[model samples]
Target: MRPPPLRRLLAALSAALATGLAVPALRPSPAATVQVLAAARDLPSGTILGPRDVRPLALPPDAVPAGALRENAVGRTLAGPMRRGEPLTDARLLTGGLLRGYGAGTVATPIRIADAGVARLLRPGDRIDVLATPSPGAPFSRTVVSSAPVVAVPRLRSDQGALIVLATDRTQAAALAAAGSSLSVTISGAPAGPPQNDGPR
Candidate 1:
């Protein structure tokens, strides 16, 4: 019969080798990644997305941004500029902000405001009214837009003035655009009435 101490030594060695072999199997694997939409090239602000403009990318799980869904993307206009290979997030595309309730037939018209300070105070979802002045000091000033939803307040350089976007009807959009730089903005509280969203798109 084998000696008790010798048998114990062999059993210990057996367990040590078994544990060593099992270590590799117990080691966790790397986290799985996913394919997400990203800009193919340097996409400028206001660029309408096309199939060629964007492509799916394989990225690490941690790198995927919130709201970067392929189904939500595609065929949307960019509100802000994006560099090449930039991931497409919800904020990167134009639909959220003031376009919240009104879904269709709304035109995003970028208008320059007379007061940069007031424009800076304006945030998305705030309702505003726009006044137009015909000439520098003319008395022909009139209210061109009343209670309009403020969409995006774009980032501006130090030398640049404040520019904001509003969603309005086709005729209202045309009139606001045709008014030129005369648009002065005033931040009203919540809209006076429920959105006059035209029937059925």
Candidate 2:
């Protein structure tokens, strides 16, 4: 026997509601959580990170990964050593290979000078200003000099610093390394103005 019209309509409406609700259930749910690696200690800016420097951040059980995952993620040091529990971001992650040139036109070069003593004062990752003074007897005694960021610090007893010259060309690198002992580097805040020769004579 067929049910009454109203009963049939009610039954159909109930089935439609169930079907609508079931669609959501059948759809795949997002991943509940993800693990992200972060720094475990204060990593200096420009410091290259290895497995040792990273720690993982696990999201809650219902959270999904928000961004692309880097399987072989490499982070570059953007600032000095970071404190423990610091979350890692692209700013601190090195996306490219080691010595991945950063800043403008940086390259490793040998800085030669007469006094190793002066070189000893500099350290890797230290910012400096390069000064040039023309030979005492050169005509047109204009001092041609430029400042390059130090990429590598000279080791104790080493006569030269393996510097990653910044904003410099091959010719400038050679000139800076070959100039007389007058070539002096004064550790300075990120370079200001053009290279200076007004330092104490």
Window of ten residues with lowest summed lDDT in model 2: 156-165
Quote the lDDT for 190 in model 1: 53
- lDDT score for residue 162 of model 2: 24
Say which candidate scores most in lDDT: 1
How many clashes (backbone N, Cα, C below 3 Å) per candidate? 0, 16
Tens digits of per-residue lDDT, candidate 1, 151-178, equal: 7887643334467777777767677767
lDDT of 2 by residue, 121-191 (tens): 77655566666555567543333343455555424243442222233445555555466445556667654
**Model 1 quality (TM-score):** 0.53
The residue pairs found clashing in candidate 1 are none
Off by over 4 Å in 1: 1-33, 100-104, 108-117, 129-147, 152-163, 172-201
